[model samples]
Target: WQVFRFAAPALMAGNAALLKHASNVCGSALEIEAVFREAGFPKDLFRVLLIESGEVAALIARPEIRAVTLTGSNRAGESVGAAAGKALKKTVLELGGSDPYVILADADVEHAVQVTVQSRLTNSGQSCIAAKRFIVVPEVREAFERGVVERMKLASCGDPMLESTQVGPLARLDLREGLHRQVRESVAAGARLILGGEIPSGPGAFYPPTVLSEVKPGMPAYDEEIFGPVAAIIPVKDEEAAIAVANDTSFGLGAAVFTRDLARGEKIAKERIEAGSCFVNALVKSDPRLPFGGIKESGYGREL
Candidate 1:
């Protein structure tokens, strides 16, 4: 999705693309290049450079490399952005996010919980726009938490190749370890662990769907992006406090609001939430027809 989002427009404009995909996904990168080639695009029009991270600086310094775009961690974005700045090349970066899902007082608790859990567990919670924080108003917080825990517990982690697998192992072992560390630290910091927080003994890098309630500002669950299947539930006093908690994060990638009242949901999604894309009664997602990307540390510029 990231490759095609930028490649389609650049190809249309008659500009070539040089992709430097993540080190672990080299085969997928080559497959993408082959896809363009098979579709009759010029042989060299879309090229994959299987290069090391240290080599990126020299590659960006090359005069033939026009604009640069990346979808990765903030650290990678900072490195690429610095190199691009030095080379005076136009750049677009789509970085990490900890998107918030706000559940209003009048929201259908069941529907909200279903959507929130599904969003949070998407891609084993690897996606940048995957909902991370669940900010619920006092009226529905208890029920919302209960529903979320039940739904999350139902998700079975297994081989991704199996159609029955709702959740799979994370992409790397280090990521699973990092996520577990966050869960532990958060729990020690007073965040209530209401569901699976254990690292299962398995062959693959699997972490179970975990839930942490009473997540506050100082906890890792609240302050950092948990890039795995973990849901952080934050309780807010009312609508005003919910919105405040939702916007308190440095990320401005994607957010969603759930409410029974359509007008109220729309109003909050449009005017109250601070994000590049805000949705009402749905999980925030990217579509080919709509503009995508984010702001603040989540990065600037748009893609779709």
Candidate 2:
């Protein structure tokens, strides 16, 4: 999606494209290039390079490269942005996020819970803009937690190719291990495991939908981006506290606030929340019509 998002604009603007995709998704990369060729694009105009990661810096530094764009972690973004900067080339980076999904006291609890379950578990929660943090007012904290756990349990976990599989495996075994490490550390740091904390005994890189309650500052679930099917629920006293907690993270990619009062949700989502994209009574998503990016350590420059 990101590859096309940026490539489409560049192609429309009469610029060529060179894609160096993630090693795990090489087939998809080749298919994208094939699609462009079949669509009447000049063969040389759109290309996919199966190059080693070490070769990327030199490629970006080439005079003909002109510009660079990346979608990955902050560490990877820093490395790419630095190389591009040294080459004095334009660059766009879309990095990791720990987006906040706030449920206000006046929110429709059922609606918020359903949308949040969908948003957080989409792509097995591997998305950069997925709502990782759940900040709910004290009045509805227990109800939100219960609803989330019950709803999350219903998500079928198995092979992604199966249409009924709602929660699929992580992209790799290492990614699943890393996510479990975060979950373990957070649990040790006092974040209570509400449901699905155990890694299932299986062959594939599958993990169940896990939820952590009472997550607060100092826990990895609170501070770091858990790029897997894990949910961190943090309870706050009031709206002001909710906003304060939402803005507490270093990454500012996206956020959401659910409230029956549209005016109040708007004020907090548009003005108070510290994120590039904020939604009121809805989930955050990337639309072709809107510019998508992040602020602070998340990334800089827009993609679509």
Candidate 3:
């Protein structure tokens, strides 16, 4: 979806595109290129480059390469932006995110929980706009935690080919290990593991839907983007504190506020949420009709 998000618009604008896909997904990238060719578009109009990350600088430096678009970590964005800037090239970067999902005291708890679970678990929670932080008012904190844990416990994990499978393995074993490390460090930092922190003994890169409670500053679960099926629940005293915690992060990709008070929610979402897109009583998602991007350390420029 991401590969096509940027490519489709560029192609529609009659601009040639050179895609530098994530190394691990090279086959998928090639498939996209093949599809375009089979559809009778000129072959030269679309190309996929399978090259090492180190080779990107040279590619960007080429005079023919007018622009660059990257969707990756902050580290990759920094390198790509640097190379593109040095060559006076236009660059679009959609990097890391620690998006906050705020649950106000007056919110519909059931609806909020449902949206929260779906948003946090979409794409196995490996998404830039996925709800990484759950900021809840103290009055409903316990209820929210319980609801999240119940939904997570019901998640079925196995081969993604199976229609019944709700959760699948990570893209790679190294990614699974990295997520486990973040879980371990967060637990050690005093966050309570409410559910699913274990790395299952299996052939594939499988990790269960994990939930962390009492997440606060100084903990990885609270401070960093854990790009997996891990939910960090941080309880605050009120709306002021909830907004404070939401804006505390350096990444400002997307954010959501859940409240029955429509006027209050909209006011806060528009005026206080420091993100590219803010939603009231809903999960943050990218729509074709609206622009998608991030601010602060997440990245810059819009995608779709």
**Model 3 per-residue lDDT tens digits across residues 104-153:** 99899989999998999888888889989999998888888999999989
How accurate locally, in lDDT, is each candidate? 0.93, 0.93, 0.91
Of models 1 and 2, which has the larger TM-score?
2
lDDT of residue 129 for candidate 2 = 88
User: Which pairs of residues have clashing backbones in candidate 3?
Assistant: none
Number of clashing pairs, model 3? 0
Which ranges of candidate 1 are over 4 A from the true structure?
Answer: none
Error of 2 at 64 (Å): 0.2
Off by over 4 Å in 2: none
- Residue pairs clashing, model 1: none
lDDT of 2: 0.93
Cα lDDT of model 1 by residue, 221-260, tens digit: 9999889999999998889998999999888999999988
| Candidate 2 lDDT by residue in tens digits, 56-109 | 999999989998999998888999999999999999999999999999998999
Residue 284 displacement in candidate 1 (angstroms): 0.6
- Residue 51's lDDT within candidate 3 is 90
